[model samples]
Target: MAAALAVTGCTSQSSGPSKVSSSSGGPAPGDSRTPPHSAPPRSPSTSAATSGKTPGGGSASGAGRTPSSRPPGQGAGFPHCSPGTLSASLRQLEAAAGNRYAALVLTNTSDRPCRTQGWPGLQLTSEGGGRIPTETARDRAHEAQPITLKPDDRAWSRLHWTVVSSSGDAADGSCPTPGALRIIPPDERHSLGTGWDLGTVCGKGRIQATALSTGEGPAH
Candidate 1:
């Protein structure tokens, strides 16, 4: 019925016989010239998104996000140093009774109190690094101590830098070098990136680099 009405309309548009289309169905005149209605074409200038990139590598817009772990502006899964502030350096290490100890400088470059929890811990890995971990240590020798420092303030704490294994079968007379990590930095906080290093608390007696206080594990 719609086709018959369209044919009648065409007959009225002209005199005599109207031209017949060979096509099965013919679109109205000018229809082919018209663009189909659609969402506006994507803007040529529209910006594209990126998945991930290094911190200093790209603009803030293209700046790739980090892997999911800690939230932005909060601290959680940092390896050793916290974000924002400079991390302290692992400067010095020294000999101890059965095991060795390390001295670290908790320096706050920024003018703020750096809050940290637990003892600064070091990992003791053997030269061979065997399975079942025959000789190694992990985690800080933490105690009931919370660290707080005023702007540019430096405080000291000591840990059993147990360089040798329990059996006392050390690789060499010297203790294997250690890799250190800071206590988990708290959320909504920052630390002074400020280089901290391993230093021994040596005195007429013992590992005196960090202050002498009993918390956990045998004293060095």
Candidate 2:
């Protein structure tokens, strides 16, 4: 009886250890079924369409726009004549006592009508391309008149100078002869180069001029 009890005890002990080892050594059947890997959620910037905007977060259409054409005759409101649109000519007129006079004529060459007013800025240049000093004077005789020129309309100004001094001595600067006149229209920046050969320009401020007019005739 003692031998049989020992054998039974040993068998129960051996079977207990076998069952525990089998259960702990390997994974369960349900655990072997792995959960699928899921990707991370995307940011708002990554999905531009969902945010109702372009990738740059602005409107895509009409990216670059330009201005439309300007209205007609808008530039004609203050149409002042430029030097390029007029022809300048000069001629000797008369001599009284010691003073000499000449006419500077400007003719419209453009198709449209333009206007000019005030005295012209004049400077005498030599044949070798040297600028001779001169001073301009306002003429109370001829008032400032806005001369409007059509396609072929013309205007004129009288330039006067004193070749002799008050004491009857020759004026300073050796009285150089002028080859060409550089004329600047009123309120204009550009100057017109016109041929001019009067006689001689003397000291500073000796030259004077009357404002342009439509009534002034060409110097004969």
Candidate 3:
């Protein structure tokens, strides 16, 4: 009986060890739970890294797009002329049949070369700096050409008006004499002023002007 009891106690102790070993061999609940939680953080970080590259690629593509238009004279390696770098003068031409004519001359006073094209803006003012009623009409018969003016080079425009009064003139059949002439370069805002002694401009102060051309105007 003593030997049998000792054998039975040894069997119970062995069974307890086997149960403990089996439970430990299987995956721990903490290990499974840790992997699932840690795995979610890695997935979000990977997606964030991928999304960050998309905007950088989009910006690179946008930088390759072309502009719709370029500024004038940009292709010629020269800049547009400004009023500050120019000097203006008037050359009176011969008068015929109640018509008067003159040449508006512009000289490049700057050392650098500049380009200009199109019609210029003109206005007449009284001696007291008062605005006069002047109408400038373009002569489309002449096409504007781009002119490159070197230092001290010149460009000119023809100006023609009537000295005699027309039906549009005031009832007195008279016109106001301009004391100053304001000349604005093409594509410029500021103006250059010169003295004007031309007696009177008729037909409601209308003046016909031509596009600028290279060199001094014809004396005739």
- List residue ranges in candidate 1 displaced over 4 A: 1-83, 90-94, 121-143, 163-175, 178-220
User: Which candidate achieves the best lDDT against the true structure?
Assistant: 3
Residue-pair clashes per candidate = 19, 0, 0
The TM-score, computed over Cα atoms with residue i paired to residue i, of candidate 1 is: 0.32
Every model's TM-score:
0.32, 0.59, 0.64
Q: Write the per-residue lDDT of candidate 2 for residues 1-220, one digit (tens) a residue.
A: 0010000101111222211111112221121122443543587655653555222222222311121111322222325566778788887886888788888888777776555665666666677656665555556484565455555667777888877644333454356677877666665545676876777766443456676677446536
Alpha-carbon shift of residue 77 in model 1 (angstroms) = 22
Model 1 lDDT per residue over 1-220, tens place: 0012111111111233222221123234221121333444466543233335333232212111121122232221122223344344443445546555543444444543333332332222222321111111222233323333334544344433443343343343433332223221222122222222342211111122232122221223
Alpha-carbon runs more than 4 Å astray in model 3: 1-75
* Shift in Å, residue 30, candidate 1: 68
Local error of candidate 3 at residue 200 (angstroms): 0.6
lDDT of 3 by residue, 29-132 (tens): 12111122133245777867655442112121111111111233331434556677888898899989999999998887777666676566566778776667
Candidate 3 Cα lDDT to native = 0.61
The 10-residue segment with the lowest total lDDT in model 1: 1-10
